[model samples]
Target: MYENKISARQLRRMIFIETFGAGALSIPAFACYKEQNGFWSLIFYGVFLAGTIAFFIIFSGKISEENFENRKIGKTGLARNVNINVSKMQTRLKSINFPEVLPQPIKFVYMIRFFINAVALFYFFGKTIQTVYMPESSFLFIIFPAAILLCYSLYTTLQKRARFLEIIFPWIITTYFIAVILSFIGIEKAMQIGNAGELWQGILSDNIFRSMGNGYLMLLCSSPIEFLLFLRPAAEERGTETKNRKVEDKNNKEGKNNREGKDDKAIRDIITAVAGAILCNVLFCFLSVRTLGPTLTSQSEWPVIKMMQLIRMPGGFLERFDILPIIFWILCMMAVLSGYLYYGWSIFQTRSGGCLKNFLGITFVCLVLLTCVVEKHTLLWTFYLKYKAFVDFPLSLILPLVVWLFKRQKDFNYQEKT
Candidate 1:
């Protein structure tokens, strides 16, 4: 019943906010631990992340969003929802004559991927808030508001979400850059350009896995773009039913023009994702060591807050600039939390379609809360790193390649048939 579309610029803003925010604070330490030179860590993160995003952009463009639109999409903004009836088929399903009742693996895998990304992020945000920001508050108290905001975001149209991000993107940049600039006061002038760290070949051999873990944090920070948002049928899509309309437009449009139009969009999509990832990440890592020396940067737990705290604005304007880091954390965490909730709820709908969606949604939220409350946050962090090392790397790389290749094969077969 709802219809929404956003410009490519709006989509780019959303990606920027998500990819750059939360990781900017704590991840430098993780990267520093892995690389002896410290510089290679920054370079590795950029190349590793840029490649993953580039693959996603090219693949998302290759498959038209309209293909998803041509079918009935769930409320979650994704394409696939396997609605299986197991009642009558309970007996037949046991007999292996249950193809119809079988769960779809692709949908299941994507669903799992989105949930893992979301939950890991959700836990991180909650932990940050619980520890540094609000030590007195209970875990549930810190997480509750975020959960509500996330639910609200999921209910709104994607265009609205993008629009909200556009408004905040500037302040996010201003606050972050100001902190980076002020950070110069804390470290030596000459060391601002280069960090003090020993160089070694351990980067390629020993510290590679930890780098993968940190790189995964960066990659999943903003989360991958949801292709169905574009591919699904827009309200204007059905207008093509008018034959006279198609003929009139066909007469006016040349093949070259159509190809150029698509190329323009494809280029914008790639350039935006790549540039945003690199720029945000590079500035973040550079500022980390430039603002705080390598030893301190690696030692500090909440580097963003620590880095921002050291910068005292001239004229004694405010007692402390530490609040800037908090603002940054809140902004980024809200966006990330909402994205996770949306993906999680969407997967629930895909699995159980009806009132069960409501039940499962509530259950999912509660389970996440319970896990965060009972589980030690440090242990959870370790599990997240291990998951990234084992699952996320292959999943992020292989999924897009498989999808892109599959699309190519389908196109080749269609051309042969025609």
Candidate 2:
């Protein structure tokens, strides 16, 4: 069923881009608001996140093994009766099968949650363009072209999206790194951390608990590593194919080892990408706090971007180096917006009928109209922030863990019966 598979490298890039979306720009502000050191909070949360993801990877591997074994056994009469059940479970486990797993009311809520998030992101994208590049342009005009482009992108294949990310990943990283480096110039010396003791003290300060809580919430809302749950099965692993019947039978005994190797590689790639993105976010947050004091950082809407504007290029070589980060930030936001649309649409596609295309067309029109009508960006942000913890936590973290545990128990029971 998975014909157009992306390489592990492409998968890593996708994860990084998704995890480091435009939401990351607000990390420093969030830290400042909570009155905590952004660097320390991010480090602590990042370690916790990495550990959780590692456990999830292990669980996913076990489920994949069970699925593979069940498929293999289905070729024989002994397991024929359980093939349908196994296939259903595998389908639910492999992808974002929320529509299948969730009840109608809960599914409706999930749909609404994702829709609101997509609209907010779309609105944010338009707002960024209007604020940074086209201050004179109408908001509608700014988003109209962007919405059209997003629709076109949504129509494209996953492989195409992954390829596009691969093409721009290096450029985006370089631009961001340049901005980060330039941001260090002309900053107050006292604002910077002087020694390891200061850094350690920051980590163990009185507000550490609050900082960790806020960091966890930020990680939940900002990091889209949950996308990896859907992407892993589609990511191609090397040395997993059998060339011929002879080779297949010869290596049949080694199949488990091969699967283990593939799982290990996937785990490593995902962890690396996630960790790199987290580190980048930490650096950006740290720079924002250092360049702009906590007061300004918390007050500013886009602290990182504002910090970029404070950058003074040496020798006046680049009059406005901030524009580079803006452009790259827009690219990252585009990837994130595309991911939201694509994954949300995929959920509908799974259950829809022959009129699915028509339904999507109507839905696109409504989405664009909603984006246009939702002018209260502040209210949207408030609403999202107020309820995101409730929704995203359950959907992203709780749901997957519940599914994994259920599958594990079922597999164990099956083994006992056998």
Top-lDDT structure, candidate number? 2
Clashes of each: 6, 0
Q: What lDDT does the true structure give each of the candidates? A: 0.57, 0.67
Evaluated with TM-score, which candidate comes out highest? 2
Model 1 is weakest, by summed lDDT over 10 consecutive residues, at 90-99
Q: Write the per-residue lDDT of candidate 2 for residues 193-281, one digit (tens) a residue.
A: 55898767766663767767767766664546666655776676433332222344333446556556766777788888888887787
Poorly placed runs, candidate 1 (over 4 Å): 1-4, 65-103, 185-248, 251-256, 344-364, 404-418
lDDT, model 2: 0.67
* Local accuracy of candidate 1 as per-residue lDDT tens digits, 203-227: 3444555655555555544344443
Residue pairs clashing, model 2: none
